[model samples]
Structure formats: structure tokens, C-alpha cells
Target: MSTPHDRHLLVVGAGLAGLRAVEGARAAGWAGRITIVGDEPHAPYDRPPLSKAVLAADEPPPVPALRSEEVLETLQVRHLPGVRAEALDTERRMVTTTSGELGYDALIIATGSAATTVPELSGVRGVHVLRRYDDALAVREAMARSREVVIVGAGFIGSEIASAARARGIGVTIVEASERPLERAVGPAAAVRLMQLHADAGVRLLTATTVSGVRSTDVGVDKVELSTGETLAADAVVLGIGARPATAWLRDSGVELDARSGGVLCDSRLATSAPGVWAAGDIACVDGVRSEHWTAAGEQGRVAGANAAGADAGGATEVFAAVPFAWSSWHGHRIQVVGETTAAGEEDHGDGFVLYRRRGAAVGAVGINSPGPMARLRRALTAQTNP
Candidate 1:
């Protein structure tokens, strides 16, 4: 191991969580050599806008860099853009990348996730998955030229893509396998309201349906066949089914990973099974739970970074226990869900907010275009979880 004077901190996957991990290390008083690696050449950028503002913009927007080169320079962070981590060797504390081998005193795995794709539509033109910056640009260009867009899955990403397509005056059809859109996300009561919002927006909602096959020409897709013995005309298709954590590189790294999700398994302190290693963001499965939201990723990154630094310095590590929170916008209406809305008793106010209770006490909430109630409910949930 390197001495304290020559200690180094290496961060893989230069996304939101990776950027925050660097910052968190500095905030925790880590003065070691810091290096961040990213498979993408561009700097870290916000992803939520890719489905919303980026697609709806008349002109292509600039790359939404989360941090400037100057900021990274000020932090003394050496960023290795476009360098993919190929493998890891926890025994030697070395990471094999596309460029060269990297040794670190402490390592943070923040690879985040990649968009899940349809197997049948593989290598077909006009099929898109919005996870990277390039994917969003390609989809935006496809939306501009297409007349009708078929989005698979009615989750938050799919709904936002539908809203963006409609904003461009393009016809949208959302094919969801679930009976109700967002049924598992915001629960049944709130999901009904969300479905109404989509219907009011004039987007076609095809529930209990699955894409069976696609008819593609030499140039692009022209039609989509559903499982219900129905086919829909489409010039473009967007797959928003879900995302898998980017953890294939860690399979043989001696790091414990969740078998189902392929996420790195960590404790409350974000420490991995391997020594001198920690995981955060989407790739982190903390106590058997993995959160894919943006807020959770950033929060986990901060905590993991501090803990990794503390491990190097023999300092006290902090626990990462917080109420889950996520927010999304669909057709100009805000949808916010906080805490565990799945198992709690829901109280629909019929206004715009639904409160979730357990044992006569508030535990969570889902707000539809109601920020005031969401704010209050989130505060209450935070207090409840903390106390």
C-alpha cells in the first residue's frame, strides 16, 4: 500500500455520482491524489433533462456539463475521460482500464447504469434508449424527423418522452405492460391520476400490451407488432423499460454483487466486501436495496466518498440512511413521490396530493402538481425517519 504522503483515490465512471464522489472526498479532508475515470469523453452532465428539455428544444442544447474543467482543476482532480474500466483486482487494489492499470489507496465505484434495450430491436435503425448524452441527441434527431413515436413502457422516462414528443407536435403512443401506468412506482390511486394526465394530453395509452415484434425497412422501423394481435404504425421507437446497473466489470473483482440486479453490495457505510473499495449511486446495492433516482445517487455518492476517505485516514465513517425521494415532470405537471408508498395506506385528497400512512402515522406521499404539500410531507418523512 502507498504511504499517507503518496496516497491516491481513484473514482470510476465520471457521471453525477462520480463527480460528487470527488467533491465529497475533498469535503472530508482527503488531500490525496484524486483521479476520476469516465467511459464518455464529455464531462459529467445532468440526465433528467435528456428526456424533457433536451428533446423538446428547437435547437440542440450544449452539453450539460455538471462541473467545469476549471472547477476540476481547482479541486486538483485528474479526469481520465473516455477511459473504460475493464476489470478490477481488489487484492492488489488495482483497476485495469482501457488505457492502463491504475493503483489506488482507496477506490470508489460509481459506474451508475445503462439503459435497458429490447432484444428484438437490436441493431435496428430508429430504435433508441435514452441513458447517455449521445443517445438523447440521436433520439431528439429521430423525433424531429418522425411523424409518430412509439414509446415502450409507461414509467417516468417513457411518460416524459411522450410529453416531449407531443410538445414537438408529433403523435405519441405509450405501450405499457402494466395494467396502469406507474402502478408500482406511485401506487394504484396516484397512478390513476397520472394516466388521466396522459389521456388529457392526447397521447395514446396502450395498457396490458407488449411489443412482440417490429417491422423495419432497410432504413428504419415502420411498424410495431403488439402481443395483443395488433400492430401500430411507427417511424421511431423509444425503449424506457428500465436500466441495469453497470457492474459487469466488477464480476470477477472479488466484490460482492447482488445476483438479481448486478449491483455492488455494500453496507450502510457504503463499504464493499473488498478491502479499500466502496460503491455508490445506481451500482450500489445498500443493505439489499438499490435506488436508481438522481437524488439517491448523489446522496450515496457523498456518503460513500466520505467513507472511502475516512477508511484511508482511519477516521469515523458515516452511515447512509435516508428517506427515499424522487420527482418527475410529465406534460408540465409535477409528480413527486417520497418515502415508501408501496406498502403504506394511501389517502387520496382528490386535489393533487396523496398521503401514505402506516399505523395512523404519515410515512410517505405522492404529489401531483402540488409542490407545497410535497414539501411539507417530505419534511415530515425526513423527521420521522431520523427520529
Candidate 2:
């Protein structure tokens, strides 16, 4: 029989979730070999700042490391950077990667998500998507040389990028396909208020619009064409329409994945359909919901890691029931949301706070520049769920 030290815990993806999984394993009394594999060349780093601070800084800032090298060393984690997981053999407990095949006793999948791109924008020099460190660097560099930027989405990522571009004194135009920006995320009323922030900041908000095509010059893109038969001059174009979970490699690995979102389907305990495996972060679809927030990623990572360790040690696994929360900063305004924002009924408090209710109970809330109200609502929601 394999001893405790003989077992190996392999974590795929080296983002916040993946790093936390390593720490979670250690905290859960997992005294075994641990290895983290990442396709990015750099070590695990914080991604939240890539759209804000990283893009706004005049000089390139060092990628924000999630954990110091010393910390990872103390954790005794073998990190394989620039290694991509190609396939998985759940039966054999082996994973095929760009470097080589790695065997593990327990596995945690936190591959996260990748930015969706426009098909026609392929190979366009001035087109960009911000997901990785390199992508941020490239966008920052492009923003410096560009006069006007066209953002193709009105989501958090696009809004943040627009904020960064405006901070650099570059002209920004946001083309959102929906009738109102963030209508689905924060409700129509709150989304309108949020949209006003862009307008106040001198950003041209084009609602119910889509980018049909692009006009490129020899150097790069020169103009962006809209579906409304409008053409706007653009030096740089950022595609922030959406992101899909990075679970393509798990398709044939005997793992159950959501057909719509391409996310790995997991149970309440974060356990995947395949035995000896678990999923977390943006790729984990539990109860038909996949949270892409940073907080959820860390929280789910810890739970999944602990559960994986428990399975290896024949211990009881913990259930993942953390409340959902997410925050975003746009145009110097802080927007916070907690719990399920899709509740049936909503009450606008008229003070930048919107409370969502289901069956006359507080289920979620969205606060704009109102931290105190948001905190109270969050606590109330937490208490409601816990009780």
C-alpha cells in the first residue's frame, strides 16, 4: 500500500484557485507530494489588477504574485510553469501535458477561463484580449500608442479596461449588444446608474450596438464598423464580450461538463463526476452555476483541495456552501454584489443600493459606492443563508 508521503496531489492551472488549492491541501493535513502545472510561463499571480492598475500604470508594474517564492517553497510545491495539460486518463490517474505525462493520486482542476474573441478579428495587429499577464502588457503598450479605443463589451472586464484607457487620456467608446450595460448582472435599474458613470467620465456608451467589422491599415486597425452602419475611428480594439471555461481537455477524460458553458460539472462538495478528481474556480459548474469571481475561486479552491485530500486520506469531505460575492471598480466607483443577483424581486433604495429579494427574503444586493450599506446587506444575506 502507498504511504501518505508516497501519494501525489497534482493541481492543474496556477491561478488564484490553483495556488489556494495547494495551501488548502497543506492546511487540511495533506502531507504528500504536490505539483502545480500552468500553461503561463510566470508563476501564480493576482489577475484582478490586470485591467485596472496594470493598465493604468505609466510604467509596467511587476506581475502581482499571489504567493511569494519563499511561501511556495515552504509549501514544498513543485511548480511546472509553461506546461499545458493536453489530456487526462482518469482510469490511469495520469495527465498528458506539453512537458510530459504526470501521475497523481488526487487531482484538482482549476483551469479557469479564457477570453472569447471575435472570429473576424483574428490576426489583427491592434486587436487584443486581456486574460494573461502577457495580454495585459500588450494592451497597455497598445493603449499608449493609440488615440481612440473601441471596447466590444460592457461587462466588468470591458468597463475596467475602458476606465484604464480613459485614465490615460485616450478616447474610449463602449459598444454593448444589450439594451443596457450590465442589465443581466446588476438589474436594469442599477445597470443604468452604472452606465451613467461611463458617461460622466466622458466615455461614449453605445447601447444595443455590435461591432460588425473592422477596417485595417497596413500598420494596424484604423476603424471599427458597427452593425448599425456606423463606423468609428479606432487605433486599438479590445474584445471583452465574454469568456468560456477552459474545460476542453476534460471532455474525453470521463468528466461531466456543462454543455452550454463548457464548465466541469461538480457536486456540492466540488467533487467531479470522475472519482479522485475535483473542479474549482471558473471551470467548476456546481448546481448549474459557475462563478467567475476571484473570491469564489479561492473559496472553492480551498474546499476542493480539502475534499481531495480527504478522499486520499479516507477522511470526511467538507461541503462547499460559501455565499457568492463579487466586486468591480469602474470609473472610480466601487460596485459590490453579494448572493444571487438574479432574484425575482428587486428594491432600489435610491442611494446607489439595490436589494434583490426572493419570496420576500433578502437574497442578493448590489451597492455602488456604498460600502456600509453593502456590508450590512451582505451580513444579512449571509445570516439568512446560514440560519
Candidate 3:
């Protein structure tokens, strides 16, 4: 391996994680030539806003850029937009792209993940999955014309879209296989109140419902069939069934990935099993901790990039030890959560109180709608994590 000062760094993915990785590498004293490749033609932009502000507006908000073009130019990072990485040649220290092969001394994989879609919805018009900028645009356009929108799954993405659709005077029906929304994350108690928020907004929530298949015609989807023998008439269908890590290209690259989540497995320092490679963001499972939050992605990207640079520079390495934090916006309320919200013991403080998830003697997680307490709890959690 070449010294960090003499190495060529290549970062995959043009999202927030990839952009932050370049910044983090430079901050760690890496002056080597850096190249970034992205399948999307557009530059790095904020994705969280896609399902929120952009989808809710009549005129979709302009793409929210994470970093300005001038900043990238100032950083001297070469960006190859609209390019897909076909394969990784670990032995040759080269990356095979749609254009050609490029050699690299160090590689950072932050390709992120793709929104999950069902096979039954494939080739079906008006059935959309929101992941890229274009996906949100299409969904927003559909909402503008449709009176009823059927959204599969009641997770974060699904709930957000429901809110967006309702904002545009479109009736929304959210279908979830689980008994409650965010059952895996926030538990049943808090989920009840969360579900109430949607109901209060005139959105319909169908719990314990399974989508059998989608009924579509030549132009677009007409109705969605449910396992409960109920069919919902819809002009548009949005699949919020979650996402899987984008790691198919790394299949033959010899990088270790967790079988369950299909996320790239990394050590304490976010270093992958492959010698010259590191990973972060939704694509990474660091020491068994896999988080899909936007904040977690950016932080992991910083740690991974800095550690990769430090390793090459033969300097002090940084371990990724940040506590997990994620927040969701619904009905104009900020739902903030810290640590693992799915812990065994849960305490419901009742109306207007934070739900605390506990394991043994320690508090494992905290979820609240109020920003004040959430901020204080976040500080406490940060101290606990650091201490």
C-alpha cells in the first residue's frame, strides 16, 4: 500500500456519504489525487428532503445540494457523473466502470442502497419507488394529478409520503404487513400515537395488511389488491417497502458482507475485509452496527475516510464509535430518536412523555416528539457513549 500522501483515492457513490468522504480524507492530511464516481448525473444532494419538502410541494423544490460545485472544485476532487462501477478488481487495485478501468491506491465504497420494490409491481406503470431525485419528481407529479394514492409499507418513507400526499389534498392509504407503523423501531405504544398523527391528517392507516398484488392497465395502475380481500382504487402506487444495500458489484470483490442485511461488513475503524477498501453509510455494517439514518451515514463516511487516510499516512487511526441517532418529520412534528429504540424493556411515560427503551440497568434508547427533551437526552446519550 502506498503512503496516504502518495496514494490515489477513489470514492464510489456521489451521495452525501461519498462527498463527506472526500472532505474527511483531505482533512486528515491526504493530498493524494482523489476521484469520485456516481451513477447519477447530478452532483451530491440531500436525500432526506426528497420525500419531505420536494414531494409535498406543488412545484418540487430544487435539488438540495449537499456540497456546492465550487467546494468540490476547491477540494480538487475529480467527479465522474453518470458513470456506473461495473466491478472491482481488488488484486489489480483497479475499478471497472462503464467507461473504462481506473487504478486506485485506496478505495471507499459508499454506493448506498436502492429502494426496495416488489416483483409484482415490476413493469407496472404508476407503481414507483422513491430513492433517486427522479423518483420523487415522478411521485410528486402523480400526486398532483391523483385523488387517491396507495402507499405500500408504513415505515419512515411510507409515512412521509402519506403526509406529502395529504398535503396536496390527495387521500392516502398506507398498507403495512406489521400490526403497527414502525413496529420494529418505536414499538407498539409509541406507534399508536404516531398512527394517530396520520389519522388526524385524514390519512387512512391499514395495519396488518399485506399487498397481494397491484392491478394495472396499459397506462397506469388502477387499483391495489390486498390479502384481506379488499381492493383500493388508486391512480398512483408508491412502494415504501424499504431498501437493500447496493453491493452486487462487490460480490466477486472479496469484501465481507453480513448475510442478513447484505451490508458491507467492516471492522471498528470501518475498514472492510478487503485490504485496500473501506466502507460507510447505509452500505456499511460496522462491527455489526448497521444504521440507515442520514446522520449516521455522514458520520460513518467521515470516520471511514479519515481512517483510510490515516492508515495510508501511517498516522493515528480513528474508530467509528458514535452513538446512533435518527429523526423523522411527520405532520409538522419532529420525531427524534437516539440509540437503539428496539431494546427489550420499554417504558411508556404516557401522553406527552418520551418512551425510554431499557436493557438491564442502562437506558438503551429514547424517542420523543419534543425537541427540548430530545436535545437533552441526546447530550446524555452522547456522554454515555463517549464515557
Q: Comparing candidate 2 with candidate 3, which one achieves the higher TM-score?
A: 2
Per-residue CA lDDT of candidate 1, range 74-122, in tens? 8889999999999999999999999999999899999999889888787
- Order the candidates by lDDT, highest first — what do you get? 2, 1, 3
Residue 349's lDDT within candidate 2 is 88
In model 1, which runs have C-alpha deviations exceeding 4 angstroms?
Answer: 1-3
lDDT of 3 by residue, 143-208 (tens): 888999899999889988998888788889999988767877776667777778888888888989
Where is the poorest 10-residue window by lDDT in model 2? 1-10
Candidate 2 deviant stretches above 4 angstroms:
1-3
Give all candidates' CA lDDT scores: 0.89, 0.90, 0.84
**Candidate with the greatest lDDT versus the true structure:** 2
Candidate with the larger TM-score of 1 and 3: 1
lDDT of 2 by residue, 65-183 (tens): 99999999999999999999999999999999999999999999999999999888877888999999999998999998888999999999999999999888999999999887777
